[model samples]
Target: MTAVVDSAKRHTLQALLSLPSGIVRRLAGRPVEIEGNILDPEMQLVLTLRKIEGAAIEERPIPGGRRALVDAAKAVGGDLPIGAVTDLDIDGPGGPLRLRFYTPRNLAAVSPALFFIHGGGFIYGDLESHDAMCRFLAERAGVRVVAVNYRLAPESPFPAAVDDVEAAYSFVTANATGLGIDPDRIAVGGDSAGGNLAAVLAQRATRAQVGAPPVFQLLIYPAVDFAVKRPSRTTFATGFFLNKRFTDLTEASYPPAGVDLTDPLLSPIYGDLTGLPPTYVVTAGFDPLRDEGDDYAEKLRQAGVAVQHVREPGLIHSFANMVGVGRSGPEAMGRAAAALRRAVSTP
Candidate 1:
């Protein structure tokens, strides 16, 4: 019964997103004010469909909500064909972590690789949820994409995710030859909480003076400062998909009680930004985390780190997952991947 309902919802979203771009854009643009900020047409349409299809997962039980969110993302993003996709398990900080490799057909001998982490506010995503995005990056940038399935919150809290990121990166760099990747050209990236992990990992590697740190970091609307509040949080507090309630739930699960949210591992914005690799930060106008992402980018620039920041003024959180919704999703992802390719391919 549950599977049938999910299938129906998936088809509904897929059908809606298959409409012509202009029609989708026009439908999305119809004026409807919510929470002070006029929601982006694309986001508004997505959210409305979510409401009707019972696709909003934040309010559901964690296990079920995670599945629903993953399904919805996969449905909207639509899978892409890759040269080859392989799944393997590698040793991580806590235990074993699943890793998926998306290699373009006709992969090069020593291709650059992006270590991707999927976003779900720390609790609700997995590799399958981000398969489309990874394939897009792999195909567009002409790089192998290594997607990590790190441990989640409540079960694996705080430093667990960070540790898994480091472990996965270490495995990739150490075994680059076997994986057919360029060790020195590896990069790290993710959206939302996954971005937070990538950012924190870069800082940790820099501080530790790792001989071969990630060549680049791509953060998409990252949750940078878990401890502090920004204007965007209040301004876009209620209506945005990443609202206070959803964030609060995810935050609590990861930190638990008595844990300080300001810990550098928890909030990478407070960590040392110097000596990190070149970074490309993407921010969405309607996201509550926008200010923190912008602030972090500025700090990286001020610290003499190379930073390319792009803010999509008419987009909302998780816009990247709306690939079939319109051109914005693919365009944003394509631009980010192009920058990533340049950064990683640099001599």
Candidate 2:
């Protein structure tokens, strides 16, 4: 019975995502309006379907949560075509880390690269989970994407992922010539927890001089500050996909004992923002982390950094992952890719 129900729900998910937005809106009924933003009708339908599916990843243990995320990504993430993919293992701060590279067609002699980090609240995400997003961006934006598989939390704890990302960036930069990449045009970007790492890396390039500095950063619905519970956390706390309970679980699972929640390394918004590269911050109106992303972009602006903040007023968190889904998610990610292409291509 459980297997049947799961299969039925997966089929329904595919069908619902295939429907026209007009039909999805009609089926979803009145718009979900809060804090002056109407949730996208497609996203609203998705939330309704999820409610029926029941038992979010947060309700389960670690392995279950990881499975849920990967399964969800597979369910909605269509196989986006890319020119090629290569995998290699490199020495990280702790041990060997696997890195995936997405190379698009129409190759340049020396292309810019994006050091992408996956977002699973620092616990569950990996190369398989975000493969579609990386493929889409690589093909559309015409950049080689170096997706990092940093060590996860509880086992590796806070600074381990941080150290691994720093090490990965340094390794890439040091080997740019051999890799056929232009070291100066590398950008650091990620979604959610990955976004936090990308922001921290961007800051560290100038502050600590970690490696060759990123030319730009694309922070998609990043959790910038852990110390504050902003109104968005309350407004869209429940009924939305990323509920407060799930976020709380992730918070508890990621940081180890005695780590300060407000440390700049943990929360890059608290760090010095000046001298960072050009930044493109993407936030979703219905997301719990929206306010913090806003504040981070604002802080970068105030610090005299070049920042472009774009809020998809109708989408939810992780909307960028739905590359094969309904209208809104793909459109929003298209804009993000265009921004990234422009940012990295500037002479």
Candidate 3:
């Protein structure tokens, strides 16, 4: 029965995660070793358990696949409880959008805010998937964190996610007074596909010449170039958690056939980076997305944008979501939150 198979799978994963870290490292099998950077032992330990669990980023039947990924993320690195969390719905281009606000226990009269997008290669994640990460950011950074439940791909492909992010940002900025936020101190951020959306939204704001555009962009291993394959795309493709198959599936679902993948709205790395907000980009050394994230940060810097780029030499992609795996993941993410707090706390 389907239920039996699902239950068996759950038990198997639980068993794997319970093994000794050394055994887990051996069980993680082998990846195509790349030159220049070694895998972080801590990350390797967690990833080994994941491999044993057989948690590939493949599409299942609709909601099932989505639920599976969300459960896996929660199982490994469940959220830290926050002081104050609330949910509200806003009008999005597609329909009503859901947003979760994470506020610290000791609330400030007016706080800087980060408009967050949850990453599941544009298909898997939801507000719940990233509940813990958002809470961590709010508590650690001393800022209000709003996580967006934007429409997913295949059904709400291409500009749908972009539209939702823009609408969400606009709503927050417009209602800053009521929301107890400083309009000029808002930033935009996300990881993976959500990071792609954040970059595009910042571009849109810059082009529109909005007076109160995002003051900072927290891009955690952003997928900036969708059309062409960068060197790292091939170098670290498989066994990296975020493999090529997932990337191919996400591309097919969102862009549709014949859509120009090079469009600035879709691939913001190709967009003019001049005059955008101060940007903080985080890249994992072993991720397929490493090179492009680094490239985008350099482009931003060259364009005279204040840029801070951090590279975790031993980690894989999506390390930000693996906070429970090791101290490195949490430490790296906390550094990003600190950077964001500093950027948004100014004028």
Specify the highest-lDDT model's number.
2
Residues 168-199, model 1: lDDT tens digits:
87788789879998877889899999999888
Q: In candidate 1, where is summed lDDT lowest over 10 consecutive residues?
A: 31-40
Q: lDDT of each prediction vs. the true structure?
A: 0.83, 0.87, 0.82
Q: What alpha-carbon RMSD in Å does predicted model 1 have with respect to the real structure?
A: 2.3
**Model 3 C-alpha lDDT per residue in residues 1-347, reported as the tens digit of each score:** 65465455445655665577677556655533567777866667566666666546584666777887777766545547678999999988988999889898787888889889988888889987788788888888889998899999888888888888888888888899799888878899999988999899888887774325788999999998888888998988787788888888888888878988899889999998999999999999999989999999999999999999999898888788765444667889999989988998777
RMSD of 2: 2.2
The per-residue C-alpha lDDT of model 3 at residue 1 equals 68
Flag regions of model 2 displaced more than 4 Å.
1-14
- The true-versus-predicted C-alpha distance at residue 195 of model 2, in Å, is 0.6
Of 2 and 3, the candidate ranking higher by lDDT: 2
Alpha carbon lDDT at 238, candidate 3: 80
Question: Per-residue CA lDDT of candidate 2, range 244-306, in tens?
Answer: 997887778777767788898899999999888889999999999999999999999999999
Question: Which run of 10 residues does model 3 get worst, by summed lDDT?
Answer: 5-14
Error (Å) of candidate 2 at residue 213 is 0.8
TM-score of every prediction relative to native: 0.92, 0.95, 0.90
